[model samples]
Target: MDRTELAQVLTRARTALTPQDVGLPAGSRRRVAGLRREEVAQLAGVSVDYVVRLEQGRGPHPSAQVLSALARALRMDDDARAELFHLAGSAPPMPGTVDEHVRPSVQRLLDRLDDLPTMVLSARGDILAWNSLASALLGDWSLIPRRERNIIWQRFLGTPDPRRSTVAMDDDERRATDAQAVATLRATTARYPRDPAVQELVSELRRRSERFDELWRAGGSSTSWPFDRKAIDHPSLGRITLDCDSLHVPSSDQTVIVYSAEPGTPDSDALALLRVLGTQSMTTAG
Candidate 1:
């Protein structure tokens, strides 16, 4: 690794970004012109110490995921993102295919939302990483095989069950969700035309589900993924409705999904209860 050069690049990038650019608040009593190492850490989902090490050129080489997150946090363009990856001793990701790499910064962001249901999805709809509460609320995804970790695959190929969602969806709602899933998959296929696994998935779906095949013929795009509203039905907690929000790290082609209920509402309390249940399950497992 070119430690000196990497450090210089990181320092220069960090110094150039403003809080406004990254959607951070501009607090008072600021000393530096740009964001602090800690602020950058928060934005990038890394530790301040790691940020310091990187800026000082003393840290170990970063992963592609970390470099990509830093690229987004620093608002680097495509050229700069490629440079970041190259300096970190990796090739740039192929165009059209989304990066499936989940950064530590993203995990840190998930860790902070213990009371909410949060999960990460790769460009191909694979469930990458999810917190305990996400498992508790969304059903235990970890129990499923890795090959079956894809959202589109499970929705269409699995047993006909709309209850895969925590809430009861009317026929129209279920149809819409199904259509969206197929459309998203179609768009992904268009983007990663050469990905063997994705191609295999398309073949499998076409062979198995007539609905998926029909939708495949129709088509869909990532740009049209609707705003999500999710509801989970817990035998113990009843139902909790959450407004689902997504943050995409375009460079990595990974998205973090957070499900939150309005504060001061019963739905919020239900989510808190689920957190407790998740904690209990962990303790028991340990």
Candidate 2:
């Protein structure tokens, strides 16, 4: 690895981002111009010591997973992400792989949807980027481990955490959701047959989740749910139903999932309340 250059690049990238850019609170304590090392560690899901060592040009070469996390945390574009991999003596993700890097345009789109809960998901259902409201409406995805940040993984193998759970649904809705998730994953595996990450996810799900295995065995070609509405059982706000829409980013094979309620409705009011209460709760928790 080009330790010195990698260190320099990492430092530069870190300094270029503000806490707010990455859905972090900008506290009054002002010591650094950009995000602190701890903040980057939190965002990248790495240890603060690792971030420090890398910045000091003494850390071991980061694995592809670490590099990808750092790239996402740094909000690096495709070119910058490729450069990061090169500096680490690792090959940049190839074309056939599921794209995890969120394009700058997509990131901006997420940012602009300030009132709505929005997130970008890869073709394989990996949660790549999300807005603050998304965290509030769904769950704080950043707190989840990198490997478990996938929708399918959460649906099947993830431990039950009420705080992190998605919308509340009945058994019928749950089965439908599970089937859709499996079908979507099946379609993704077909599209990126050589992608190790996709293969690994499927293998683990089949091994661990009997329900997932059953659906996978009885495969279908459908990639979307027949229904788009969902009801979230918020701890504070009770049940709030919203229209969940998925917008496709065909260029990168990504989908931008957005949650919205009808304007001037109770659900809309509840969402607005979440914009304030949820952020404060997150900041306090952090």
Poorest lDDT segment (10 consecutive residues) of candidate 2: 277-286
Identify the runs in model 1 with alpha carbons over 4 angstroms from their true place.
1-96, 160-165, 220-222, 279-286
lDDT of 1 by residue, 43-85 (tens): 5667789999988889988976578667756767677778888
- Which portions of model 2 miss their true places by more than 4 Å? 225-227, 281-286
**Per-residue lDDT of 112-212 in model 2, one digit per residue for the tens?**
98788888899988888888888777777778877888888988988877565357888998898889888888989889998999999999999999999
**What lDDT is obtained when candidate 2 is compared to the true structure?**
0.86
Clashes of 1: 1
Q: What is each predicted model's overall lDDT from 0 to 1? A: 0.72, 0.86
lDDT of 2 at 139: 73
Clashes of each: 1, 0
